[model samples]
Target: QPANKVFPHFVPSLSGFSLTSEVKTQDVEYDVPKANSTDGKDEVLFGAEKGWLGTPIDELNRMPQCAPPLSHLKVVPNHTVTVRTDLLREGEVPVPYPTKFKDAWDDVSVKMPCSEKNLFPMETEDGGGVQSRWELIHTALQGGFKKRSHLTILLLQCLFFPTLSSLQCLELCEAQHLFEVVLPAMVSLALSAPRLCTLPIPLLKSRMNHSLTMSQEQIACLLANAFFCTFPRRNSRKSEYCNYPEINFYRLFEGSSSRKIEKLKTLLCYFRRVSQIRPKGLVTFTRQMVNNPPNWESSQTQLTRLHITCEGTIEDDGYGMLQVDFANRFVGGGVTGHGLVQEEIRFLINPELIVSRLFTEAMEYNECLIITGTEQYSKYSGYAESYKWKESHTDETDDWQRRCTEIVAIDALKFRHFLEQFLPEKMVRELNKAYCGFFRSNTNSKHLSAVATGNWGCGAFGGDTRLKALIQLMAAAEAGRDMAYFTFGDAQLMRDVHEIHTFLTGRKVTVGRLYSLLNQYSSTVCKNCRTTRPDESLYSFIYQKVSSQTATDALKVISDGTDTKNLW
Candidate 1:
């Protein structure tokens, strides 16, 4: 895992908010020939050892088409005492942790310090006077949070104020007997500490490898630390740590809507389970990249055959394979805001992935993220704003001691103007980004599974469905992988994509030809409609051009073995 010199790491900007330069590939180095071609003037060629119009192309033959078996990979979980609690039922209701929660905390508290002063203020000026941690938590829960009722209150206490007495706040607990056994040990741990609960220093550092493996218990601890708002200086906007994504639980407490409360129930339910059970195996957050990204203009790769469907999710469709997340540059994508998309849904399900934000810097266009071994703690059904976290389930681990999951975060460019995305440079930028994310394994090894993605940047980013789909297909082909595209209920997109793909496949169109056509098509459209027009779709244009008898005859004439001299 050596660094590629061609893609040198870019330093963060002064504000520490955005990338200042191009992104560098992490932990991977591979040899690529230098091309002599200048930008825009060089002739583009595919499958040429001499290099595609001076833009060097790595030999695809050496790259593996499929990933190596899990047994061959080593994924070790960080050492932490696991708390077992699998007996809890899953449904609409939130459940408290097992009675063993306090005992587990007591065992760990010996190594960790406790707070000498009160964790919360004794009283609030605007509200009824609260005297203790238990009372404050109780009062917070009393405002008609009826989703899981008593279990919610009890779990909140265990998560935030581990040492708060259940007996002392018996009125808050509608079922006093349920938490009596867990409260004593929990209170002892809370009274012992007011300092921030933090991760081990080594675990928090940003490294070249950019890979971190944590046990379920460790993830629980990190999240619980956030729950208590114990992470020092995290709450302040001006804090040095403000550059990092928000990890504290302050946002959840800001509003009192039922939807917000439901979100809380989902989060606590996960905590309750982790507090009780030590999940087996580990999860790894590894940021990945293409060591020598291909210049898309010169790539001659063919569109790897795709399975286009309007149904299913990326996780479900691409199971046991690498699943792509259309992430924001900062990752997690407004999980703390009102926005909810695939990224948010993925985070809500596999909450551990959210912790990657703690160290992951804002990504550049060429950068993509790879997360392995994240366990899904909850189930959900719905898209975007309607998404609901439903039921609890255990993720089975693979032979390599990793969870049976691999997610790559590939952020699409966000265009303020619709026409901006049609520019050739923008398309090339997207092609590189998608290829970087799709190109799995290294030069010596390959993970050949098809990518599962669809409607990627089309939603919030305002990308053309047909155009983005083609871009993704080209990138996947260049990466030596097929694609399983989930249209996510966009029937027209599914139909258009299928027709275009069918036509292209029938003509045996290489990626280079389509790319050339894309460039031509983009240029033509821009000229045809100076103003942004929705009717002139890339799919319709391609279909008309490729399906024409003249175009077919031209294709037959140009077909001369592997080398089609006339790209136009």
Candidate 2:
């Protein structure tokens, strides 16, 4: 059974509340400190330099060098693309060879009409008729279809054009441009797949900092093949790709839902934009792992800087910072399915990210995937079930080494029992996972940027927001990065987090102290039947304990005759 369905909602209590407990109905406003101008150099934040793009590409462990050897390519030109038909073999020579083409068509066949096949006549201009969408796609794949084929235009029209009653002039024009210009060019690019993917794409395996860099054209070609559902052994769980996320467009095209339609609109928009102007920049995907775990109780790392707010989103306001993706262990999560949360929406706008699922293995607990240089193509409104594609977005963010944006994907644990999260072992697991994502070994310590994150693992994963905020805070501080926390419109959470952060920083709290406090709190909760009392919350406990400890320290100092004059 799914964990979410099994766990009851567990709300924390706040007894002995010394802090302001009144929940604010209105949005709380806070000012984010601006970075001082660096005269075209990297900005500095909290005594550390901002952004990692200035670091050399080679130094970052990026693959597919500026000029990679063609011999490393598994799908070279004038050769057959050898799809991995089984698990990767040890000591095997990965290469492409001539072979017969085999199609692994699934139940969701593309033969069905974009609309209803029976609704329109199938007659063509050449005194013949097209039977199915597959025929057109197959012809294009074999390089026999004309760019101006009327049948292709009709199919595209059926796919994109809405019913006449609701079709506006602008929508019609966009659809017209897509079918007439963008799609044909993309189909042509797909035909040249052999040349575009000339470099051997390495699988970003577990426990490694393996990076793969591919040009935008190469990504487009790969996506084009996905659109055509040309990749073999990818449609079924019985195939070798059973361990990988689905890459073909069959599932996207075959489904019927308002959610699916909106996703399709977003994808079509991405294809249209890329087809018109092929991007020249390169994107890198790196799988990062942490072999040596931190000793949470003994570490003396100080809390880094923090900027917490209830307004704005991680992607929008957190620009130039290392953005966090509340992801599934499967990488792209449910972008290809019904999911429309933070990670899925991100993948849709930046469709290039979808390519990572092709070679990225299912992540381990100590692993995270970092993607840099991918551009956004669409804007969106609403979330989850209410998600809608708003319009095209033009990104003007500056790039370093042809890379602009950076995102780190981390999967949080899904708790089966609500109280299980309070266990010491579970809390430690979360800290290490967040630390792995935030840590940057390739760059100098002074060059690490702040992390932009929100209520990670708090939504469907059932993580307590207050606890998660603190966990990420400790992890970021240990990794030597500051943080900007967005509450996703939770005003009360934002205020509470801000107050706690101010208290910790003002008290000169160390990471070790914080970790010890967390364990103490866990022990208290366990002693009380593994559930917090209605009047007892993590915040109140920390506030009361820290206050008591500070008072005791002052008393001790006075008794020892240290600063007695000041105490009097």
Candidate 3:
């Protein structure tokens, strides 16, 4: 009988608090990458040699995504362009490609809607919006920087953006600092890098099938707003923006340590890059979720082949395939949290993924978020607090689009109690989650590649490494996709998983049959060891039931440890 049929009674309640369940709420915050605030404490500037004051993000000003040339391109008003990330052939969509920054900027700027005379809602009967906005900006500067001499100059310098002509007549300081200090700084930084006017058309077309292109200037403006701590609706406890990753410049302002200085230097470097160089390519964010996706019990798909390895990181080894991000249920787990992990690393490298938090609500088990064409900004050497931004990363793009990497986020469940995962219902839920992520649409399946994953839930989530590995394997089989499993640094798992896969593949066992075996194993094993931990591992236990009687010799070989080297 199929596992579902015989193990019908083994399906536990999908939603119930177990003995290990505990509610956690954090009042403490961490100073991590991209932590910004409008409280004036996390100011984005410094004085002279040690000044943390705002530096001109020239790239954002120059490459506004919604600015003129492409501004005329019809899209949902106020929303950036949305495009598919699936692979596409050359010349499929005929859109004008500008080869110079000036041309594109002028074209788009001409189409920019005229700003309402009453732009600020809080404007008085007189024209006080500009002054009011300035006060708001001035007030958000860190306390020490809020003093007169430092404050006026910083405000004037910030107004150096070409779009803010409204501040021209403001009687702040004489134009000396604004013109000589700030304008020159901004211009020097902008001119230092080549203008990103031209699109890497050939490379973009060849690499990704579809994408959403945003102007670098637009990105710069957003970052500038973040840097100045001017973004509104970002500070409340139950903020509308809470679902989104924190984008304001709050966390960087929360400290005076060497780490914060190092981060500041890196942040300045990023702004400098944005100001000087226009990206030679485009970026696309695509959220892939299967519609009417299959349930585990009814799945009949076969596993695509895979390669299991012990050493190497997922980003480096699994460059082109849809790499998996072991995410939190909320997505981008504690990326801003004090403790860093794989998901945090992924977010740091492709900072663009953080934008998904703006619109994406908490993730359900069967949903997955995918991103394509996000560039990596910093290179780091270690994990977590030991993680340091080593240097700027310039990835190659011409023939292969730059940052045309694809990442799918699949959040593994956090079992409060280790044994709760053994329940058949939980296993089925995990299977469905993985299958939704792994199953490529019929049209894209031929071109879609296998998945790269490892130690996904083995870290902070308290998941059993072996069990998680098996769940991923079964899901891949159901989706008919190959998998490249990265054990991160776990060498032993590399061996044991290889043996288990080899054993299963050799038997030519179908997923339905494996489900049946898993069901039988869980029920029998749980009944026998209700009070104490099983003496045997789950893998050994499952093997004992599935192949022990028929392949007793194989079991003996594994148990003896003499046949370990050539299991595959």
Query: Best candidate per lDDT, number?
Result: 2
Q: List where candidate 2 sits over 4 angstroms from the true fold.
A: 1-176, 396-401, 530-535, 564-568
Report the C-alpha lDDT of model 1 over 430-462, residue by residue, as the tens digit: 888898887755532245666778787876798
Model 1 TM-score (2 dp) = 0.66
How would you encode candidate 3's per-residue C-alpha lDDT over 281-314 as one tens digit per residue? 4444444455565555555555445466665677
Model 3: lDDT equals 0.51
TM-score of each: 0.66, 0.72, 0.63
lDDT of 3 at 176: 38
lDDT of each: 0.56, 0.65, 0.51
Model 2 lDDT tens row, 1-568: 1111100110012122111223334433443333321122332232122111111212321112212232332323322223332322323322221132222233322111121231333777887654655444546445432333443344344334222111122233344554456556767766555445543455566666666656666687778777766554566889655666777665665435657766766776777667767666556677888988789999898877676656678778776678899999998888877788999999998899998877777899999999987878877777887776666776642322334578999999998666778789999999999999999775544566678899999878989999999999999988877788888877678657766776776677789999999889878755576344324788988999898988888899978888844322
In candidate 3, what residue range of length 10 has the lowest lDDT sum? 1-10
Better of 2 and 3 by lDDT: 2
Where is model 3 more than 4 Å wrong at Cα? 1-217, 256-269, 398-402, 531-533, 549-568
